[model samples]
Target chain A: MDEMDNQFVTSLKENYQIVFQEIGLLEQAFTHSSYVNEHRNMALSDNERLEFLGDAVLELLVSQYLYRKFPEIPEGKLTKLRASMVREDSLAEFARECGFDQYIRLGKGEENSGGRQRNSLLCDLFESFLGALYLDQELEAVNQFLKKVVFPKVDAGAFSHEMDHKTKLQEVLQRAGDVFIDYRLTNEEGPAHERVFWTEVYCDGQLIGRGQGKSKKAAEQDAAANALRQLNE
Target chain B: MDEMDNQFVTSLKENYQIVFQEIGLLEQAFTHSSYVNEHRNMALSDNERLEFLGDAVLELLVSQYLYRKFPEIPEGKLTKLRASMVREDSLAEFARECGFDQYIRLGKGEENSGGRQRNSLLCDLFESFLGALYLDQELEAVNQFLKKVVFPKVDAGAFSHEMDHKTKLQEVLQRAGDVFIDYRLTNEEGPAHERVFWTEVYCDGQLIGRGQGKSKKAAEQDAAANALRQLNE
Candidate 1:
C-alpha cells in the first residue's frame, strides 16, 4: 500500500477502531457499481453484495436491541418501531455521521451527478461497511460496534426520525397491483370555521385505519399514518 | 413451582444445558397466548414478544453464516437461499427436532385442536426459545445453540426444504402491492403423445421468466419457478 492508502487505513482504525485484516474487504465496501463499471482492471467488487449481508446483520442487531429494551411491547408495535429505526433515511443519517460519503468511490459521471451525498448511496454504503466489519470482526464485535454507534442514538431518541407516512403507505400499496387503497371521509362535524372531519382508510374494502382532523387532507394523512402504524410495514 | 414444572425445568437444564437465572423467563418462553388467555390468574406473557426478538437474532446469525460459507455467491442468490433457510416450515422442522412440541403450554381448546404440532405455533416456539436463551446467556451462547441446531441442517442439505414458487412469489409481490403476475403460453410444439409446451411469465407487462415442459400446467409451473429464480424473491 502507498503512504496515502496506509494513512487512510490507519485513520479509520484510529478513529472508529474498524480494523480489516483483509484490506480488500474495506475497499470493496466503498466501491460503487459505477466505479467498478468504469474500471476494467479494478480488482474490487461493488458494495451491493456486502450491503445485502449487512442489511440482514443490521436488522437483526436492531431487532434484538429493541426486543430487550422494550420488554413489554408487543410484536406489532416492535415491528413498527423497528421499521422506523432501520428505514433508509435513518441509516443514511448514520452514514453521514460516520463520514461514509468521504470514502465512497464513485465514477466520474456519478460523482459529477452528486451521487456521493445521495440518501440511497449512503444507506447502502453504511450497510456495506457493516458487512465488511462483520466478516473481519464477527457478530460480537459488530454488536459492540453497534452498541457504540447506534445504541446511543436509540437511547437519546435521536432515531425517532420523521417519516412521510402518506408517501410511504402509498409506495407500499402501489407495489401490489390488485390491492386498492381508499380514504373515505366518514364524518364531518363542528362549525364551518371549526370543522372536523373523520377519515377512514381501507385496503380492498377492509377498514385498516381511522383518524380525525380539521381538513379532509389532514384527516387523510392522519388516516394513512394510522394505516402504516397498524399494518406495521 | 409444581413438581411437574420442576422436573421439566431440571430435565431441560440437564439435557440441553439451558440454565435460566429467572425461571419465569423460561416459563414465559413456552407460554402460548391461548394459555395466558385461558388462565386469568397466570402472571406470565405469551411467546410472541420473544419470538419477535428471536426472529431477528436468527436472521442475523444465518446471514453471517451464509456470507462466510459462500464467499463467491452474489446477493440475489444468497437472499433466496437465506429465505429458504429461515422460512416458517424450516423453523417448525427445527422446533420439532428440538422436541418443543411437548413443552408448549397451549389452552385446552387449542391443545385439543392440535395446536401443539401446528407449523406456525412450532416456528414461533422455536424463536421464543432462542429469545429466552439470548436474554439469559447473550449472543455467544445463542450462537453456539444455533450452531448446533441450524448449522448442521444447512451443512447436511436438510434446510433446502420444499418451497412452492408460485405461492411464494405471489406472497412477496402482494406484500409489495402494485405488481401483477401473469403466466402466458408462448409456444407448443411436438407429436401428440410427446408434446412440449413453452411458457413465459410477466410482472406488470415486463417479461421476467420463460420455461418449457411437457404439459401446459407443467409449463406454467416452470415459468413461475423461473420467475422466482430470475427475480430472486
Candidate 2:
C-alpha cells in the first residue's frame, strides 16, 4: 500500500477499529462519481453502486433495530422512526461525526463548488462506506460498526423530536378540550417527477397553519409542525 | 402443538422442506389483522410487524442478488429490476405458487369478502413468512428459502419484459434513422395520497401514445409501453 492508503487504513483502525479484507472496496467507497469522471485512466468505479447496496443494508439493519427495540410499537410508528434515523440530514450528520468528510475524493470542480459539505454527498459517502464494510466483512461487521457510530444517537433519543410532529401538534391542540382536527389538501404543483403537495391544518374550523411537502402525509405533518410552532409562539 | 398447528408445521416441511425453530413466529406470520380481531380471546398478534421487517429483508436480499448478478448494470436499472421483482403483484404470484394463500388465516367476514385470493393480502403473507424465517434462522436461511422459491424465476428471466420499456421504445424508434423522442407531462390529478400523473410520448414532435401512472417516470414508462403496444398492433 502507498503512504496515503496506509494512512487511510490506520485512520480507520484508530477511529472505528475496522479492518478491511479488501481495501480497494474501501477506497472505491470514498470515491465520488465526479472524481472517477476526471480520472479515466485509473479505471476507478464511483461509490453510486455501493451507495445503492448500502442503502438497503442500512434499511434492513435499522428495521431490525427498531423491530427489537420497540416490541409494542405498531409498524407505522416503527416505519416513521426508521425514516427519521436514516434521512439524508441524519446520515450526513453521522458521516460528519465520523469525519468521513475528510476522506472523500471529489473532482476539482465539485471541490471548488463546495461538494464536500453537501448533505446528499456526505449521506451517500456514509452509505457507500457501510456497503464496502458489508462486502468486506458481511452484515455482522456492519452491525458492529453501526453499534459504535449510529445506534448510540438512537439510544440517546436524538431523533425522537423528528418522529411525530402530528401527534405532538394534536396533543398541544387537545390540551384545551376535545376539538375537531382536520388536514385539508389545498394545492399541488411542480412536474410529475417532483410534485409538491400543500396542506392546511384546521382547528375547529379555524385555519391554524399551512405547509408543503413532497407527499400528502408529509405535507400534513409539515402543516402540523407549523401549527405547533405558531401555537408555541 | 394443537392439531391445526401440527398440520401447518407438517405442510411447511412437506411443501418447502423447511422447519422453524420458533413455530409460533411462523404461525404469527400467517395471522392477518382481521383474524386477530375475530379471535380476540386467542391473543394472537397480526403479521403487520413481521411484514415490515420482512419487506426490508426482502429488499436487501434482492438487492444483493441483483448487485452480484449484473455487475455491469447501473444502480438505476438494478433498482428498477428489484422493484419489478418485489412488487405486490409479483410477490402475490410467488405466494400463490408456494401455496401460501391457502394457509393465511382470515376472519369470517374477510373470507366472505373474498380476501383469501386478494393480491395485497397474499403479498403481505409472503413477506411475513420471510420475516418469520429471518427471525427464526437469520438471513442465510431466508436467502436459501428465496433461492428455492423466488430466485429461480429471476434466473429464468420471467420479469425482464417489465423492465426498461422506454429503452425498448427508443430502440424501436431509432431503428429507422436519427429521431428525437420526447416525453411530456400532460396532466396530474387526484388527492395528494393517490396523485395520478399523465404523460405523452412524442416522436419528432408528433404524439404517439398517452398513459398515466402514480409518478412522472412511471407515467413516462407507461406512455412508452403504450407506444410500443400501438406500434406492435
Candidate 3:
C-alpha cells in the first residue's frame, strides 16, 4: 500500500478499532466515481455499487433495531422513526462524527468545489464504508461497527423529534371530544425520480391544512404538521 | 391450539416442511388485523408489525441475492430487478403457490369480501409469515424458506421481462449512430399513497413517447417501453 493508503488503514485501526481483511474493498469504498473518472488508467472501481448494498444493509439493521427497541410503536411510527434515523442529514452527521471527511478521496474538480463537506457526499461515503465493512467482515461485524457509530445517537433520543405527526394531530383534534380526523392525498407531481406528493388534513370532514412531500407517508406527516402549526397559531 | 389452528400447523409442516417453535407467533402471522379487531376480547395481536419486519427482511435478502447473482449488473439495474422480485403481484403469487391463502384468517366482512384471494392481503400474509419465521428461527431459516418458495422463481428467470427498458431503448436508439436520447419527467398527479408519474422520452430533442406510472423509475420505464414500441412500428 502507498503511504496515504497505509495512513488511512492505520487511522481506521487507531481511531475506530476497525481492521479490514480485504483492504482493497476498504479503499474502494472511499474512492468516489469522480476520482475514478480522473484516473481511468488505474482501473479503480467506484463506491456506487457498495453504496447500493450498504443502503439495504443499513435499512435492515435500522429496521431490526427499531423493531426491538420500540415494540409498542406501530409499523407506521416505526417506519417514520427509521426514516428519521437514516435520512441524508442524519447519515451525514454520523459520517462527520466518524471523521470520514478526512479520508474520502475526490477528483480535483470535486475537491475544488467542496464536495467533501457536502451532506450527500458524506452520506454516500458512510454507506459505502459500511458496505465495505460488511463485505470484508460480514453482517455481525458491521452491526458491531454501527453499535459504536450509529446506534448510540438513536439510543440518546437524538431523532425523537421526528415522531409521528399524524398521531400527534389525531391526539390534538381528539381533545375536543373524539373529533373525526382524516388525511387525504390531494395530488402528486414531478419526474419519476423526484415525485412530489401533496396531502390535506381534515377535521370532521373540513380541510384544515395542506402540505407536500416526496412520499405518501411523508405527505401525510407534512399535512399533519401543518395542521398542528395552524392549531398552535 | 384449536382444531383449525392445529390443522393449519399440520398443513404447513406437511406441505412446506416448516415448523414453528413459537406457535403463537405463527398463529399471529396468519391473523389479519380485521380478525383481531373482531376478536378484541381475545386480545390477539395482528400481523401488521410482523409484516413491517418481514418487508425489510425480504428487501435485504432479495438485495443480497441480486447483488451476488449479478455482480456485473449496475446498482440501478439491480434495484429494478429487486423491485420486480418483491413487488405485490410477485409476493402474492408466491403466497398462493405456498398455499398461504388457505391459512390466512380474516374477519367476517373481509371473508365475505373475498379477502382470502386478494393480492394485497396475500402479499401481506406472505410478508407476515416470513417475519414470523425470521423472529422464530432467525434470518437463516427465513433465507432457507425463501430458497424453497421465492428464490427459485428468480433462479428460473421468471421476472427478467421487467429488465431495464431504458437501457434497451438506448441500445435501440444507438444502432443508427451517436444519437442523443433524453427522458424527462413531464408531470405527476394523483393522491400521495398512489401518486402517478408521467415521463416523456425524446430523441434528438423531438418527443417520441410519453407514459405514466406510480413511481419515477416505473414511469421512466413506461416511457422507454412506449418509445421502443413506437420505434418498432
Best by TM-score: 2
Global fold similarity of model 2 (TM-score): 0.71
Best by the DockQ measure: 2
On a 0 to 100 scale, what is the lDDT of residue B161 in model 1? 39
Error of 1 at B147 (Å): 2.8
Candidate maximizing lDDT: 2
* lDDT score of residue B145 within candidate 2: 87
Pairs of colliding residues, candidate 1: A174-B178, A175-B177, A175-B178, A175-B179, A176-B176, A176-B177, A176-B178, A177-B177, A177-B178
Second chain alone, TM-score for each candidate: 0.66, 0.69, 0.69
lDDT of each: 0.81, 0.89, 0.86
List model 3 lDDT by residue over A10-38, tens digit each: 87898778999988998889999999999
**Which regions of candidate 1 are displaced past 4 Å?**
A1-21, A112-114, A159-233, B2-17, B159-233
Model 3 scores a TM of 0.70
**Please, what is the TM-score per model?**
0.65, 0.71, 0.70
Minimum summed lDDT over a 10-residue window in model 2 chain A is located at: A167-176
TM-score of chain A of each: 0.67, 0.69, 0.69
Interface RMSD of 3: 0.8
The reply for model 2, stretches above 4 Å from the true place, is A1-4, A162-233, B1-4, B162-233
List iRMS (one decimal) for every candidate. Answer: 1.1, 0.5, 0.8
Per-residue accuracy of model 3 over B200-227 as CA lDDT, tens digit each: 9999999988989999889989999898
Of the two candidates 1 and 3, the one with more favorable DockQ, higher being better, is 1
